[model samples]
Target: MASNETPRQWLKRTAGRGARWTRLSVIAGTLSTLVLLVQAWCIATIAQRMVIDGADFSSLTLPLMLLPPAFIVRGLLIRGRTICSARGGIEIRQSVRRELLERIAVLGPFWARRQHSATLSNRVWDQVDALQGFYADYRPQMLLCGIIPLIILVAVAPLSWAAALILIATGPLIPMNMAMVGIGAKKRQEDQFQEMGRMSRHFLDTLQGLSTLKLFGISKHQAQEVHTASESFRRRTMRVLRLAFLSSTVLEFFASVSIALLALYLGFVYLGQFHFGMYDHGINLFIGLFILILAPEFYQPLRDLGVHYHAKAEAEAAAEDLMPILNRRVFERDTDQPAWQPEASIALTLEGLSARYAGRASPALDNVTFELHANEMLAVIGPSGAGKSTLLNVLMGFMHPEAGGVSIKEGTRPPRALTDIRPDDWQRQIAWVGQSTVIVSGTLADNLRLANDAASDDALLDALEQAALKHWFDALPDGLDTRLGEGGRAVSGGQARRIALARAFLREARLVLLDEPTASLDQASERLVMDALARLSSGRTVVLLTHRMELLALADRVLMMDQGRVRALDTLDALRAPQGPLARPAATDIPERRDV
Candidate 1:
């Protein structure tokens, strides 16, 4: 993982893998450097003839003409380098984001529940964007810093070996200074990114719960907490920025000192005081002019590297958060494996099933055993926190069990472990309706078609009718095309529940799971939902969790659960028998039944 990798090593590894994109950028930068060399030679030659040799404008014509084109070409190369770098950075960002999204989808709800929406958003957006400079600017400039200075040294060697020696000797000092100042930069930037994430999460949570805070008259207190968090984040961000600024200042200082030393040495040679390293006709106008002009260009790439170094630090920090997610182990599946297609009838068996969550004291499902026959409807009855929802999550492949396993048995075929089933296939054969409806901001038809994107308008209408929502849509001006939910028309609690039911009805799934689907509905709404549910459950295996006695009549059998264990599984009449343990009023009294 990049978390354990050194910042330099991680940067090199990721940048190396993207050589196809970055190669063009490096080539462009090198060509630009070569063009600058030609420009410097042209300027030096022209100056020498005009000043020392007493040449006229006619003698300077060719060099003057060559000068403009060199500058133009150099400018064009710089633009090309910028373009190539941006494209490479964008390509890398897209690839990484795609991989992260695919991993999140495979990890399912269990992993998603563990992460805050704000934290994940920060990772996918801000953290990913931070890598742009590393791929585009830092990687290419790193190469140029090494090669360009060597090119300048070689160009100076023929004129005066003393100057070449000075250039070579002083070049290492800038990087040495930059390295010393940049100590712990990666860790600091990582901490900065973390603080930003925390700030984002805190703000989002506070904003979402604004109404609740107002109700409790503690909105001011929460606001103060948010302000405090923002201040902390601001201070941390400044620290990282300060470190970057200090690194840049140190690099510039060394580069300036190196150039000054070269200038002083050239001045002594020109004065005829130091003449040891010069060749014949040494330290004349042309040689002195050329070497002096090229001095800053020699240190230019290093200065640029110092500037791009912050990008490396930022990307390293992002990678520390990014790599662990990419390296996470999710549900294993063979690439060549086909989707699992169930028959018209589907039966499920659970053998000594047990599942637990991290850092939890007790198992969510404890040695639970049950068989669901094909086309049978079973109602699960249990108090709050009795593992009803956990069972559904396990059945849907969202959560993995710690011990034992679930398998599907087909007619005359061997039972296959649920683990053997591909996620896409398993999900294709099942539909779910939770207690609270998910009303995304979209058209009524848009929301309905989410269950089956390929479903026709007629199919959607049929599902809506089955869920007892046909009248509501029919009365709307746009009918099934009516816009609803957030940012659209608001829907009541019962209408939203029916929409969720309609989504399930629209699916071609052979199995259906409903978790407290009618929990908060009034009698009228419950009757409507139950009517739609009864029709929807026909020819499908259904597992429902409801407190409504009327809904239990639809179940072929009832499963009683307490403390993660199944206490009984029997026909409703059998369970309701006077002598039956599940017949107790405390166990059987649903809200509606108790009021009755």
Candidate 2:
């Protein structure tokens, strides 16, 4: 079932499962508090026996002798609580990170484009790091702090109601002061997170585009911009630190004052200068010492909470940043039904298609129309920015048309809009080879198996032969098993393109879409690619987008697009003849194949 809960709610629900550990930790904490109270009681009892009864050191030592067991119990509980808190911290961090990744996967390319890579990285690492405080310290300490104070008050009330009243009244002041000072600190921490995300994104952008900057001789200027962003982030961090210190200082001041006031009240009782109704016994050295030792313990959690409050604020700020991308709606229509089957042959039709990019004034493709028949090879030739790539994207279902839609004709179905078909289904029937070949980090066989996981070694060899990459594979020390570096950077550009084509060949899809299949190849390699393409297209539907005349000549029909519309669609000879749109070829034109 789909969950309607927001991210924060989801986090709460997931964290609540750790209630078992929380309960265990609280039990240990309470046991530790009891041990402390026993130690205090033992001290008071021993002192009363020593002073009031005038007893010798060896005569009355039972209460003092019980201290060892209490100390041992306290030590074990502290260690166990620490372990539980650490486990909870790890669980929350991992759970939140996994949830974020799953949401991103569901959102796909639509959500990815809206977010900066570095910003997302920061949220996953830096923002999630802040949540350690929430799980590790704040949560556990809050429980312990509340429980310990109540236990203290209950134990002391019967013995000295006036002392218990004073302790309870001043205890709340620590947290009250924290809340008052922490509000502004939390706000500042949130702003600091935003600035850090912006800085990270700017740095990533600069690094990714460094080659372009160097080519244009503007690298230094871009470097200066990075420096400026870094400086801005540093300043913001400093502002956050200043607020943090101020909040800590304020919390400390109030906690110290409260502790001092409690001590002074106990001192008056110790000197027999004051007395509470029905509790006339003066406070002794033992009681005074107990109160002094417990003073720091009572205030320590509040101080820690002040610090963790900033961490929670930073985490929430990051969550707010990532929430929109996770919540974004991508193709709103349902696609739960099984896919339709394509017939033996496929035919594509686009009628009155128009598309304008988001936040753009002019349409990239306007009123575009075309028809590609079954088992026919069509070549779409155009200049840069002529909407040739846009056409391919729309056909592949990567982008939706604003006005009319693409349709596929199979048999008695008449014609069904591409949007009506599932993208995964349509993609399975098609083999796409583009200019910038993507080579994942793996062995040659691993990359080849991406198209058809069930492909045998023999089938992979056949694909390599078809792509003219068999010789290259043979030269490798491990043949198809040789590892490729990241993005195939270890191989030449031409080799990477051949490997990509080999992948497409392995798929053996009925519809083959080649976008500049021979762009990176030499003359000999180009001929080999063209021959392989001709052989592959013999019994399949092929759509080739290129400017090369030799490849265009193989097309059953050539489409010449200008400005977002198909200006001509006919035989290559007819289009190249006098009075055709591309009648005159420039001298510098190399007739290279294009890729979308």
Candidate 3:
């Protein structure tokens, strides 16, 4: 979480971690300040010597000798400040990025589902870019602005109190004016960022749904939506630009006005019309001339502070959006439990399970009791909206049940809820093949390695052969090394599914969960997939969720689901009897299978 401090306070907090660098920067800034003051004093002394005493050039050589060292010190200080600032900026950027990545990992699937991909992408890149100002430009400029003016006042006061007083009075006005102008600018900048995020999200959604729209002949309508989103984004950005320009104009006006007022006062003293500090003598002409030259340098840092304030405002807006993700509630349940290591065969049970979505009237799964012993296959059959997929999510520990629990039993200990089991252990023991497979952009070997990083070339080939994809791989120019396009777009749908199944086979998990794995395949592809599934489930626990009744012959038992509850569970033959609740409907497309 970001500190809710004022800008100055927040700047202080950010710099506090880099105290050593900050101290070095401050020292350099101080040296730079002293050099500037020395130069001013030397010029003033030289002018006074010439005008008041009518001195020659030879007599003024000693006073002019002080210029080189002051310039050299000033240059060195500037270089030091630059180095310190760069180091600080890099450290801060790395720290923030690390924290953001950790938060994302902690939030897990819940956060990923809720967040727009483009918005998250922008936060990871653009928002972090925006934060560079707090470390690089803002902190250093703030130090200089806060410290240099005081140094100038001390240097100039003894020489000409009138000039010092005028500078001191007007110096505070620059930042104050900026603050007033920026209040509205910050709000507008935030709005612009939000609008940009909205546009990004809409574009991503449109791209994802473009295929669907094309299938339905409505892609042209989606294009119109894209155009509208783009224009809205453009208008919001113009508003942000308008506010930025107005802020700059206001800061410039105040800076110019302050400098002009100081100049007016200096001119009066130059004409011997103003006096201060009990001297009946009018202001010294040489000192008045030097003060005029030095006044702008004193105010220069303040003007820079004003400009960087806009950058800070933009950064804060980004940070505000990021804060909720960093502080989200999703990861609060992870405990300090030991890692799970099962000693015997894996068995699973769901007892009186019921779950509802966050804002739903009724449960998606109610009293859904079932069990699968080791090396057994269970087929779950249901209509389109009968919660088959939801059951898989709960059994896989991706979702928690509202009224019951999923448990794993072993030889010794009492049955433990799936929630209590370590996630790494559960994931290591289970492999999933869903209707939509993930085909990352990589070579065949590279994709296989995702399931088992230590799998040898021979092992990969064996898995591919089992999934009926070995001939496809062999025909490719590079064979195992052939590169697949993004999401395996280069491959046919059946080939992609085979690759996914090959990945699952390579994992060799104790349990396999298949969700409509043959959904869109042709007859030959479906037979190949079912054969592959039979081979993979040879010695593992298998749960198959499908609508095809012909596949039930492969299962040891079949569970029928209706609404959110399990209607019946029995052997396939028993469930197919005339009196069974799962008796085939008149419109069912499935053909009964004969014994092999």
Best by TM-score: 1
lDDT of 3 at 353: 91
Q: Once superposed on the true structure, which residue ranges of model 1 sit more than 4 Å away at CA?
A: 1-11, 479-481, 589-596
Better of 1 and 3 by TM-score: 1
Lowest summed lDDT across 10 adjacent residues in model 1 is found at 587-596
Candidates 1 and 2 compared by TM-score, better number: 1
Clashing pairs in 2: none
lDDT of 1 by residue, 180-222 (tens): 6566778788888989999999999999999999999999999
Residue-pair clashes, model 3: 0
List, residue by residue over 21-50, the lDDT tens digit for candidate 3: 766776787788778878877788788888
Local error of candidate 1 at residue 422 (angstroms) = 1.6
For residue 215, model 3's alpha carbon misses the true position, in angstroms, by: 6.2
lDDT of 2 by residue, 410-459 (tens): 75668888887887788888888887777788988898999999999999
Pairs that collide, model 3? none
